[model samples]
Target: MPAADLTRAALSAARVWLVGGGKMGGALLTGWLDHGVAPDNVTVIDPGLDQGPHGVRLAADPAAPLAEGPAPDVLLLAVKPQVMDSVLPAYRALGGGPTVVLSVAAGRLIAGFETAFGPGTPVVRSIPNTPAAVHRGMTVACANGHVTDTARATCEALLGAVGDIAWVTDEALIDAVTAVSGSGPAYVFWLTECMTQAGIDGGLPADLAARIARATVCGAGALMDASPEDPATLRRNVTSPNGTTAAALEVLMQESGGLGPLMSRAVAAATQRSQDLAG
Candidate 1:
């Protein structure tokens, strides 16, 4: 089916049972509610939920009866990776249905879900960043072979509730996703921090420098997102003959090895570590 049709199907029929009410889960819940998903359709099961917005049902334990009705159409596992085993049993009754099981826990794989649930259970694993808390998250998801087209569409819809979604057939690539977008936000924040320090060194006021650094990066990212042109083209448009930006680019793109190679190494290291964790 077309991606658009899939999206529509998802929005029309998605009934989500979110297991964690932490930052990512709360962000997704907010996005869904904001996007017209009936709060009555969402059942959040989180022991730590001290407070929740109106319309959605919150439960401190999974054994509690759902206020909406029966089991959810989709079960979203958002709890921490370490506590997944403890949380799985509570939602196992839903595993027998046509429901799609979706997880945003880093390093958890499809096999792990199958073990916790039952064989042939449809599963979609994703790596989402904290930016998801603000409805700007980038999610990379992959479904187990047991997942059908409808199941995949359902998973996509649940993920789209938060932000952008990308599908991958190869589960191994999920590790790379973990390294890139999953951890990518931290890299951006680090850049902001370094830029602020540079401004400080350049003798700008501390507060002004911090604001400038943040606004520059945020604006640059928004521009990149809005533009049809490639990032390299956009970057070149900002550079001029012997200009300060060019000088900085020259150092950043040095021939021997520069930020590009250094970042590549960092991503590779992170990817390997994700694989290790999954193992």
Candidate 2:
């Protein structure tokens, strides 16, 4: 099978109302605009945000209300999870219509959105990682049974603006998705930190070590992204007979307590945490 071309999807005609304008919201809005979505077609509702993408309207919250004016084709919820319960009800008025609510907020579930929007309403729960800011995000989304094919496609189009998207049929897998990709960036950053410190310990200057660590991680990631071969194949390609890379991999790939086992445990812990939060 071939990879789907998410960028080819259209959001040019959809009326979008974003309910938050913080980091993630800004990333999504910027990516959409960069992909040529009309500025006038988008509106942002965030009380704290005094500005947003050029030509996009910024509406104040609570008193001004999201339900006001014409309803949007998609109403995106990008607010903090802690405040979701307090803020979601207000957006309910915008639902039960043509609007398909798409949530990028971690830990918020589709059933919760359906409850707020009333039963049988289209809702999409997505977990988009921080790479979205760079327009290379990987988003995993799943929709409620109420969501039609058209609504799902619109959600995909809207999200695709930020980067690639993976549509899941089972919502249960979303917690794992969140743990893997949603929290994956932090793990990669931590790896960079560890590598940099190791280099400094090995007598390299602090500045040089840091730069090398950053570049190596980033360059390797770029290679992995562009390559058709799997990561294991790439790793093998870099390993020479009785080489330094092989020696390092010996320590890192040890069966019992190596990167593979440790990463499995780490992802499992993150996945469990996500499931707990969802519960």
Give the best candidate by TM-score.
2
Off by over 4 Å in 2: 1-9, 62-68
Worst lDDT run of 10 residues, candidate 2, spans 1-10
> Model 2: per-residue lDDT, tens digit, 69-140?
677788899999989999987777766777888999888888888888896678899999999999999999
- TM for candidate 1 is 0.93
| Candidate 1 structure quality by residue, lDDT tens digits, 49-102 | 877888788889877754335767788888999998888987777674677788
Error of 1 at 60 (Å): 1.2
Which residue pairs of candidate 2 clash?
Answer: none
Error of model 2, residue 240, in angstroms: 1.0
TM-score on alpha carbons, each prediction: 0.93, 0.95
- lDDT (C-alpha, whole model) for all candidates: 0.85, 0.87
